[model samples]
Target: MMKSLLNAANFQLLWFACILGGDNWAVAAIVLYLIVHHYFFVESVSEWWVILLFVVLGVFIDGALIFDGWLVMPPSIWTFPIPPPWLLGLWAGVGSLFFHCLSWGLTRPWLLSIGAAVFAPLSYFLGADLAEVSLGRSSIATWALMAFIWFWLMQVGVFTTRLTIRRNGRTHHV
Candidate 1:
């Protein structure tokens, strides 16, 4: 049982989950800042609530994309034959990590949005390629496109989040 638990695929899945959760945690830092600083104040919404919502949304999006064939995992990783749950977990983990990383930024919303749009895709592709090599999958150009799509999605998420905060009459902190 221990051997099976320590299998390579399982380890990969674990790492992926960590990344997903970590990114989301990072994002939560930003939300916390907004709440404490009163930059994006919403009467009905609390920081924890927004964080939870973002976590759920990120998980759902990741799972849906993987299940729909928009993204492919490494071939050697058969531990997650059922893609949805694995992806959902991974998304949550990675998003948390990202949020943590960007928590202390002083940039404006538009700048942050643009930066995320550009970097997210590049980072996704890098991660994908690393996964592919580790999984021994054939190289494909579609992965590049997948990275671009990821970037676009990240941009949309940031844009929508910012807009929502602004609509609630919150001031931009940076």
Candidate 2:
């Protein structure tokens, strides 16, 4: 229980690091956070694949939004189309949440969907504002789109993770 709380705090720190630090500030934080997470909090080796899955999903969603002109990111060492690396770091951390801080929500689909719909878009808003990025031509529309995507993402993500994930040689029934 305590570890889950600590993990939640760690995730918040990473979120701030990604937003305030930008890609520049997030490099060390991402590396250190992932290392500590894998060492101390990971419940199963399969969780790494889940992280990869989210990386791809997040990149795809953000990339599609960029292509459709719904989201905009500032210039970075990385080029156009692909999301900035710091954003990828944030996605990885988000994936890691299911096994720890977000575990409680996985079992309650309606609650998870509602919370994700609300908070995920809010996070994007906060991240965009903090990072000084633009949300395409319309912030409201972009946020709504994000809300839709995140609502489905959490619902589907928990479904897939539940079907596949096993912790300590047994399925995580929670």
Which candidate ranks first by lDDT, i.e. highest? 2
RMSD of each: 11.2, 1.8
The lDDT of each candidate is 0.45, 0.82
Model 2: residues with Cα > 4 Å off, grouped in runs:
166-174
Worst 10 residues of 2 by lDDT: 165-174
Runs of candidate 1 exceeding 4 Å displacement = 1-45, 75-90, 93-107, 133-174
Over the stretch 41-143, how does candidate 2's per-residue lDDT look in tens digits? Answer: 8867888888889989978988888778777778777675678878888888888888777778777877988899999989988888889888886777877
User: Model 1, 1-174: lDDT tens per residue?
Assistant: 333222323324444543453433434443343343233222334333444555577656554666666666554324543443333444433333222233223234455556655665555556655445232223345445545556555555455445545667764332
Q: What is the lDDT of residue 108 in candidate 2?
A: 88
In model 1, where is the ten-residue run with the lowest total lDDT?
A: 97-106
